[model samples]
Target: MCGIVGAVAQRNIVPVLIEGLRRLEYRGYDSCGVAVLAGGEPHRARSVARVADLDEQVRETHLEGVTGIAHTRWATHGAPVTNNAHPIFSRNALALVHNGIIENYESLRETLRGKGYEFVSQTDTEVIAHLIHSLYRGDLFAAVREAVQQLHGAYAIAVEHKDQPNTVVGARQGSPLVVGLGEGENFLASDALALAGSTERFIFLEEGDVCELTLERVRVADRDGNDVQREVRTVAAYGGAVELGPYRHFMQKEIFEQPRAISDTIPQADSFDASLFGDAAAKAFGEIDNLLILACGTSYYSGLTAKYWLESIAKIPTQVEIASEYRYRDSVPNPKSLVVVISQSGETADTLAALKHAQSLGHKHTLSVCNVGTSAMVRLTELSFLTHAGREIGVASTKAFTTQLVALFVLAATLGKLRGHVDASLEADYVRQLRHLPAALNSVLALEPQIIAWSEDFSRKENALFLGRGLHYPIALEGALKLKEISYIHAEAYPAGELKHGPLALVTEAMPVVTVAPNDALLEKLKSNMQEVRARGGELYVFADSDTRIVSEEGLHVIRMPEHYGLLSPILHVVPLQLLAYHTACSRGTDVDKPRNLAKSVTVE
Candidate 1:
């Protein structure tokens, strides 16, 4: 995934483009570049390290322009290098910045080479500018359209022509693109955050949509060159609301903010109105007899958790499908079945396509639980539940997963009430407990200091094991995922009972095994599992309820949790793992926030 920004305006566009790229840096930060059409020629500056380096170069070079496009690349097609960076230029120096993959780039490059077009870079993005240069007649829009049609696979492209210095043309197929409306100016970005400071109103581009933007106006067109009308929605810049308060990283801030997000998701206690489901959602769910959840990564884990809640609490048969595998399967959906798509950024290409596939199978009921409001998946779905986790900058999801759980729990409760499986008193009790989750989360966050101490053991170890059972098995998997994602430590999670079966053989004196031993029905079983690790000469770091007293043996390092919390203990137990991962990564000199070869959003399939 990469970030793309373009602006056509009367004012100096360099500063605006740079600011926009700064906001969009979380999308991709491997390499950054900016191309400005100034003095009837494209002037480009780029860096292979960070956006700040590119900003420094921009200031030093004094490349002024009224129109420009910028990019922060994540290095998919080639290595991260100045030559392989984005804002790729044509032979005549017209610049283009692109996001997503060009599946047919190798074939396209061969064709361009036969035409005597010498290439300067190894990026798939470079092929587009050369193709445009070869095919350019007069109309930049026509050239861009023809070039896009020839290209295969996902892309969101922003092109600036040396001939048309005041205009910026953009097109999107599978990647995200947005047009920000401003007075005598227009902004183009892959996300709304890029244009937050510039304008509030934006028009989201759909698949096969193209637009040409000028200082005064913007025009939209379809693939066949027909003028198309689009709905422009106002985007409120709530950037300040996402502040981390006293936390170190957004991941830590969000890890502690889960309770608040949960509370906000379930505002009412007494009301079990079907109207909260929205009209389309209510009608869809009412018509469906079964439900299928499709997602990937952390969202898929959440979907797994939701399957348990839906079947047991809501009394509905449910299935969870991974998006990548679902597409290739012959498994079909019926008209009476519903498809629930879960994605933090509704722009996940596989999940979006899976939603479409479900719809094509005559499944009319499609609902999405997404954090991003303007993402393509949200637009494609019939109904959406927007999570209030704010901007999760970290690649590994912390708050989003918990918030999705809260939303799914509430939805299940609502469905149970609708089916007469639950009563008002029971629903009210769950809602009240949810309201108290924020403060409980704060108490859990207080364990970070202990977690930091526990991380010292991890810093010296090469491998670790995380163990949990029942509903928390998925949470343990998530905890292991967080550690491996940030710390680059080889970690595995298993059901505590399964430790003796196979994973225990990996336990040695050098291994540190972290057990999620919350004071619940499975506490004794988990404690026995910890004993097995200790007997095998394995060091232990246990996160348990303060009330659940266990003998601190020679190899046992026990972290006393706040208290015995029901259903919410998994949420509490995960905080320490996140802290452990962060501290361990810091000690190992690894990039905690931006792990190697991973982007915050996987926009391409």
Candidate 2:
């Protein structure tokens, strides 16, 4: 997970590169650096600091140039420190920024060392810079093309040389790279969102394609040194960086933004139809006999929840797989099965790879519930449902998760209609609930005060367990993940009945047990599970519906859900868990927005 932005222009492009890095800050970085060919000398500065801090360093040092490259690195090969920061320079006036792993770096480094190349920093990326510099042959693009042939594993690299003052060369293998076309200027970045401010037109370089950028033009070439053509496309209108207007942190702001996000994502009650999944969805649903969902992180949890909706409502058998693990394992694929991928930013590396892997296996019927229309997953999938959750800046997803649930609910309901499982009144009831969802979300947001009061308990704990049954089981897992992600607390989730098997042994007075107590058929069983926790001297934090009359007493605490949402309860139930994690992280003084060791969009696997 890293961000790369480069520019070639008539004027100083340092500001543009810095702004692009700021926009990319949400991708999660441990350090940031910028390199510019100032006065025909590659001048650079790096810091194990935030982009904001990097900006101040650039300003204080006066680093600027007409052509430049910048990087925000999430470490994989070395410790995250100032010395290991990006824009790794070589003695031959070359500066390079890389996004993915160089798997054969150790052997390459040893070979380079034997060739009289001295290394300064311990990073897989540094080897690339040194190798490129050693192989320099007066042409930057040609030299990089030759250098990459000697490398192994994934990379999206942008290289600039002091001698080549007006150009930047970029190459991609497994990671993503794109070219931004502008008037009298050209650019390269890892994502379209990074270049949205300067250019609307983009050329997405295919895997193994190397491209050169200058002030007035961009040229594309294949790995074998032949000229190629890449089609330039316009990006859809999208919101830029969100301002922290009134909230203390982006996580908090996103938690409160849920009401508006949910309202915008769900279709209007009057517009409810089989066409909600786009024109091709109906055909795909009709043709498919089973479902396979691929996703990672929070999206994987959303897929888990969708499995329940698909099996119980649509009568379709569904299997959810973590996208990163799906392609590596041997599995059966059905040509008639719909392969669904869920991602907030459609550029998630593993999910996209899994989509391609499934396609290679002859599973061509594909769909995606993604937020960005311009993302690669949308382009690769047969059909897409774009959620209007807008720009989710926080690394720990809030609005995007709920919005994906809304999209999946629509997909499930549409399949139900096609399968003749829903009557007119039942369909109308679902539509009515969609119309009332905004109001319901607003009421759920009201429970924040009560959640914060309970968060005082969570803040003091070292470990926690989440329990849910049936559909809410995924919600419990998501809650545990959120807590661990943001608060650095040890947390786990299990089905309520699974306690007696193995997890109940870990419950103690020091451990807090969080239970999802929705008033459904499983409520009584969940209560018995809560009793088991209580018997182990474990404190209880129960999220329950209004009618579930379980009150607060000894060793138990209850946070009431304003209303029971029936089939759509998971979406509402997750809000309090989000609040619980946010407040607990705040109480622990952890970074809520950009959590440690985690990036927002994982562009590299």
Candidate 3:
């Protein structure tokens, strides 16, 4: 949830460090800081404000140095205050910036305190600084290597020593860290997006790998202290997606960009092909008899939707698991199952861990649906489909979720064809629907003004309920998640039939009920569910198709969708929910782009 940038250069690197932190602001942070080895001493400036304010503080203080590290921290283990910010120093000898939590910090802090180390901040990261200082033996890299052996949790740290100017040492355990290759200088960052403005060549460090950066060279070492080599790859930069051009917030821009994102994710060919996922996808898909989809957050909801498609269309049994819990519980392993991991950033810690766990259980067929091609998930999987939702800056995902659905739908269609469930006519029909998805998304996005009107009522809501059936049930879950994530509302979702079980008791005049009323087989049952809500005096807001004759009355409100896209309606229904959440959060005056305590890429479990 935090961001880090380190630089070792001949020129003053303060501007570079600040720019990197600015690029990383999308990750969601509460504090920003910069530490520099200036004039044989460590100096730092930290603020519990925006990066712009931190930049102003640095500029006003005239902070300059040849080597430096900067951080934007999303609070964990302590409150978001200046005293708990990063760049925590140790006895004026070393400075460190960390990304993940340290599990054994309490015991380490006690040991350090016993060694006469005084703590100034309420942060686990401060203990790391003291530990490194206590282990210093004239080599910054050696001290960091020794100190990390005692640590017991995920961390990506960059450290600097006053005695060794123009040098930076970076270590990675479970969190992500990268080395940016420059002409005369080298750098370290948590993601390539942070260094996209400076250089494209990067070395993604492996787990337990450490690297030392200087003006002219970069040296890598493994966990056992032996010299190692990491592959260097070039990453393309995001051109205009990084800028907010005429939109009020990144979330709004992402909502409107869903049409383009979906179009780019799917091909307009006459038939779907498994090779689009990877070269070996066809063989792997042929060998798998069962499907296991794993993900977290919004991606997990997308997987839940895919389970319906794989089972009904592809004639394959499928199961979806939340990535955070998949590795913890004991479950039966099937060697013939295809393990699919979905993530927007590809670096989600629990999803990646789950993928590795499945592999450890002898699941050879693995695939990843992700947005970033250079992410750990894509690298670790046997096959991958990269969604072209470029640079999603919003903490709540919009375009990324839609594009992932497109990819999973394609996967479902390809498997159906291979399994003899989809004939030529069915394949052509699937292709036609996919090719028309962009236009369908455009028409759905056109209903924003009406959705905004509904949001006016929802903005006054303290609690809400969403109802959907079959494929749309997952969409309802996603809508509830989006509303609760951005608008600070307590929202819950249940299948339309499940309303009678227990959720119907929560219905009242004060509770707003949002229903996905597509004109499918479940429309009649959904209509009955709406009547149940109406009988309970619950106000109903329904996103219905043009032909689903659900008209608006006193307590019932209906917004007709442009069309009813069979099997593909979930993608269309989700756009309106996104708009509702976005406008509601706007009316509530909450930060739509950077929601509280949520990060764009969840790198820590």
Candidate 4:
């Protein structure tokens, strides 16, 4: 994944470019650079540090231009070195910034080398610059159009030539690129969030679409070079929403914002309605007998939790698959199956590809459960539920995951209503539980001080084991993922019953075993699993419901949950694990917002 922002304006564009890069840096921050055609000549600055460093370099060097392209790279093909940074130029006559991978770059490099084109950086992106350079006879748009036809992989590129000031050419193949419309200026970025305050109007570039931006107009063309018009959307800046108010980190803010996020995701209703998703959802739910959920990472874990809800509550047979692996394997196609794709950004490349893969296999009825309403996944699906978790900036998702669970639970309840599995009393009770979730989450937030105390021990830990059973198993998996992601702790999760099968051998005093002990049917069996871990001299840190009767002992420590929320227990139980991971990362002094080798959105496969 990488970030791209470009501008063709009447005034100096360096400040706008830098600010955009700062906003987009969460997308990628290995290296950053900006190149502008200043007075019909190329002026540039780059850094292998944070985007702030790049901003300082541009300011100190007085780099300003009427036209520019900037990038924050997340090193896919090359190392995060200064030379490999973006704004890759061709003889200083043309400058370009790109996001995504080039699959046929090696061959393209060899072909360009035969034509006297020299490569400077060890990046696949450099080949595109040289290729565009060779194609530039006079027209920048023509050259870009010709160059992208030869590119074999996903890319969203913005190019500016020295010969053409106040003109920028942008193209999108498999990555996201949007055009921001403004008076006397137009912008291009990998995400609309980058151009939030800069502009309120945007045109989401379609696949194989190329566009040229100037001070006055924006032109778009299809892959075949046919002129086309894309609908312009007015998007809110939400700039104030992302601000960290009195919080140490964005992760902490998002963790504490869970109550509001969950409340917004599930509106207060006496009974869940299928119309809440979309008009087509009621008919589609009645037509489908099975559910197939495709997602990646945290979204995938949410889908796994949803599988239990969908099967048990709705009585629908559900299957959860990792999006990246779904297409590669052969599987049965069910026409009656409702295919669901879960994502936060909704631009996740693998998940989008998997959705298409499922569509090709005849799974026609589809739904998207994601945070962003304007994302590719939501646009492609027949029905969508936008989790109103506004702008999750932290690399490790907090509010987004919980909100997705809330949406999925609502979806399950709606399907149950449609399938006649849920009576009026049961449906009303589900709504009551949903409405009470926010207050329940606030109570869970009170346990943060205790969770922070646990983090003191977790900071010294190198490895950890998390155990859960049934629906909570996925919560354990998500907790392990969060711990490993932000805290740099190697953590693994397994069903409590599966510990003796293979993971039991890993138990020791050095290994901190965390168990999600809800007072459900499996609590007694989970207690037995705890005994096995204690027998191996492993210290157990348990997050148990008050009714579970789990007591603190010499080798065992317990933090009781605020409630045992029945069907919604997973949502309540995961908050403390999130707090545990957050505080542990804080205690370890790791970069909680931008963890190394991770991006906020995986826009590239």
* Top lDDT prediction, candidate number: 3
Alpha-carbon RMSD, each predicted model: 1.9, 1.6, 1.1, 1.1
lDDT of 2: 0.90
Tens-digit lDDT track for model 4 on 392-482?
7889999999999999999998898888899999988898889899999999999988999999999999999999999999999999999
Q: Ranking under TM-score, best-scoring first?
A: 3, 4, 2, 1
Error of 1 at 217 (Å): 1.8
What lDDT would candidate 3 get against the real structure? 0.93
Task: Output the lDDT of residue 138, model 3.
Answer: 91
Worst 10 residues of 4 by lDDT: 235-244
lDDT of 3 by residue, 125-226 (tens): 998999999999899899989999999989999999999998899999989999999999999999888887788899999989989998999999999999
Q: Give the RMSD in angstroms, all C-alphas superposed, for model 3.
A: 1.1
> How do the predictions measure up, each by TM-score?
0.96, 0.97, 0.99, 0.98
lDDT at position 217, candidate 2: 79
TM-score winner, 1 or 4: 4
Error of 2 at 331 (Å): 0.9
